[model samples]
Target: MKKQILTTPDGESYPILTGTGLLETCGQEIAALTAPCRAMIVSDSNVAPLYLEKVVNSLKLAGFEVHTHVVSPGENSKSIAVFGALLESFAEAHLTRTDIAVALGGGVIGDLTGFAAGCYLRGIRFVQIPTTLLSAVDASVGGKTAINLQHGKNLAGMFHQPAAVYCDINTLKSLTPHELADGAAEAIKTGILGDPELFAIYETGDPENDAEEIISRAVAYKSKIVTEDPQEHGVRKLLNLGHTAAHAIELLSNFAISHGHAVAIGTAIVTRAAVKRGIMKNDEGTRIINTLKRNHLPTDSAFTAKELSKIATLDKKAAAKDITVIIPETIGRCRMEKIPISALEGLFADGLGEQV
Candidate 1:
């Protein structure tokens, strides 16, 4: 197994382990980080059926009293109500500060379980076992944990770092093509932001043959950035490259659009706007849209600029009267653009094109 240790600016550190069959050793990893005790394995209906028993057995083998709680799958489960319910489960399971909470599913499971761990008895240890590619590369490594509110996605959350992260590439084999493509959007974003070579992997590398390296590299890039700006007070904001408009599209669609697809569209829109303003070369814009298209990700949204603009105002990235966005200044580089709220409609309108 290959390991990457993520250290935050404040000197906090955790290990992210990636390789085939890493999940079976999760209990030993967690035991080494903290004492052997009760662990609440929080997962969703979708994931629990597949891997929960194996994880529970691993923890039990390591002398941990394991308890499992499974929620219904999907974004809706990442709610305050579910979070509250999980907290009750923790209390019922008698989990203490020494006992850890293990997130055994995808991003939704990680976020909700992490938040509960953060709030329960003030705070408790937690570990991440991200099953989906999206969570493996992006959500699981960073300490950013949250549940959506009626207002916006991840409107409420905490910077609760996990004790360790287990990203078993073997788990990715079960992912559908759409699920795999969902993660490609984030990988593409990572490449565009800092690693042109990584970007080329999308264009040239075979995902089935190169999945491990791609996930490791993407996690490494994100780990470096998160370590530098854990709370997103500075460079960390750059990580939200296409998220500003992406979140808006998700909300406007009532979440019919998944986060990754919305981000694909958002990246396309930002590049289009950048190209129009001469901040990005037309070829760079074309490359991004083409890369997303090649991955089967959507680069256009049906939502109008006016509708998106209204929702964009509610995005967490938006400040008093303007929303700060990360725009690609060139391939492998980006700059922040804090656009006035009133002008957002025009920006989206200008960026909108038939790339579907």
Candidate 2:
């Protein structure tokens, strides 16, 4: 397994392990970090039947009293009701501060389980066992855990770091091509924000053949940023590169559009706008759009610029009058720009190549 340690400035740290078959050893890996106490393995309906038993057996062997809680699979599960149900499961399982919660599915499972673990008993440790490529490269590393609110996605959440993260690449083999593309969007976003080498892989190489390297590099880049600005007070905001418009797209679609696909559209839109405003070169913008398209990610949305901008104004990133948008100056470099809410529509118009 390829391993990297993310150590925050406050001295909090966790290990992110990426490789094939890591799931089978997940319990021992987590055990090395925290004692093998009661573990509530939270998964989704889709993943439970496939790998839950393997994890449960491993944890049991490691001396952890294992319990399982499975929810329906999809973005809809990242709701207040699901979160409440998870917390109740924690309570029913008698999990304490010392016990750990294990998230054994995709990003939704990670976010839902991590948030519930953070809230139950005031706060408790959680371990991330990401089964999908998106969660492996993104959600599994960052301490940010949240549930979608009626108002928007991830409006209610906290930064509760996991004790450990086990990314078993083997699990990705079970994903559909579209699901893999969903993850490619985030990896592409990561490459554009930082890591030109990673960006090149997407442009000219096959990601399926380099999954371990991709996950490790993405995790390392994010770890460096998160370690520097754990609370997102500064550099960490760069991670939201395409998320502003992406969240708006998600909310507009009632999450019919998955997060990664929305981000693919959002990144394309932002890059298009940057090119229009001369903030980025036309060649770079074209490269980004082409790469997303090549990866089977959508670069255009069904929503209009006006609709997206209006919903984006209500985003959590918005302040009283302005919202911070991450604009790419070039691949491997991005800057956060705070624009007034009134100008958001114009920005979207530029991105859509419509008359502003």
Candidate 3:
């Protein structure tokens, strides 16, 4: 196993373990997080049916008294109703602070379960077993947990880091082609933020998959970023590479764009504009669009400039005067800029001309 540990604001170390066959090794892994009071393996119906048993069994063998709860699958389920229902279930189980919850699916499980764990008993411990490429590369590592709102996606959430994240690439074998593409969006963003060499892994035009070395390198790439800024106060904001406009598109789409796809489109939109302003090379931005296209992901989504502006205004990153965005002057470097909403409008418009 290739493992990287990140210490949080409270000095708690969270482990990100990347490899094949790491699923059944939960026994030894969860030891650091709890005293084995009780464990709830929260996941979605689709993922629960496939791997819940293996996960529960692993925890049981590790000496934890385990239980399972499965949510209906899809982005729509990330809401107040479902979250309320899950919280009730946790209370029914009488989970204590010593008890840990393991999110056993993709980003949805990680976000939903992480949020619940953050709130339950005033913040208990949880482990992330990210099964999809999108989750492993992005969502599962960061402490950002959120559910959608009537107005936008991920509007209600908190920054509660997990105890450990288990990234087993073998899980990607079950992803649909589109799902695989969704995760690659983040991998590409990793390159956009920094790591041209890591970005080149996709140049051969192969998809993100159970490739051992590639998965480990991607984990390493993100792990370094997470460590430098565990909380999104400074350098961590740079990790938002393609998310500024991505979130707006998500709001306009009614949360139709999966997290990765939204970011993919956002990257293309911003990169294109960055080229126009001499903030990025035109060819580098083109590379992003080509790579996303090769993976069969979106470099653009349908939305008017007006609606995009509305969502941008509502972004949590937006404050009194400016909206902070992480734009790459080029690969291997990113800077935070607080740009006016009007300026972002023109910048975003240019990327729509071409796909990344």
Model 1: which residue pairs collide? Answer: none
The reply for model 1, stretches above 4 Å from the true place, is 353-356
Candidate 2, poorest ten consecutive residues by summed lDDT = 27-36
Residue 243 displacement (Å), model 2: 1.3
Q: Judging by lDDT against the true structure, name the best candidate.
A: 2
Clashes of each: 0, 0, 1
Which window of 10 residues has the lowest lDDT sum in candidate 3? 205-214
Candidate 3: list runs displaced more than 4 Å. Answer: 205-210, 354-356
Q: What's the lDDT for candidate 2?
A: 0.91
TM-score-wise, the better of 1 and 2 is 2
Which is superior by TM-score, 1 or 3? Answer: 1
The Cα local distance difference test for each model comes to 0.88, 0.91, 0.80
- Using TM-score as the measure, the top candidate is 2
Residue 314 error, candidate 1, Å = 1.3
Error of 2 at 194 (Å): 1.0
Give per-residue CA lDDT, model 1, range 1-356, as digits (tens). Answer: 78999998778899999997777888888889887999999999888888998899999999999999999998998898999999999999999878999999888999999999999998998999999988987989889999999888999999999989998888888888888888889989999998887788887677657878888889988998898889998888988998878999889888889888898999999899889888999998899889899888999889887788889887887899887878898879999777798888887877885222
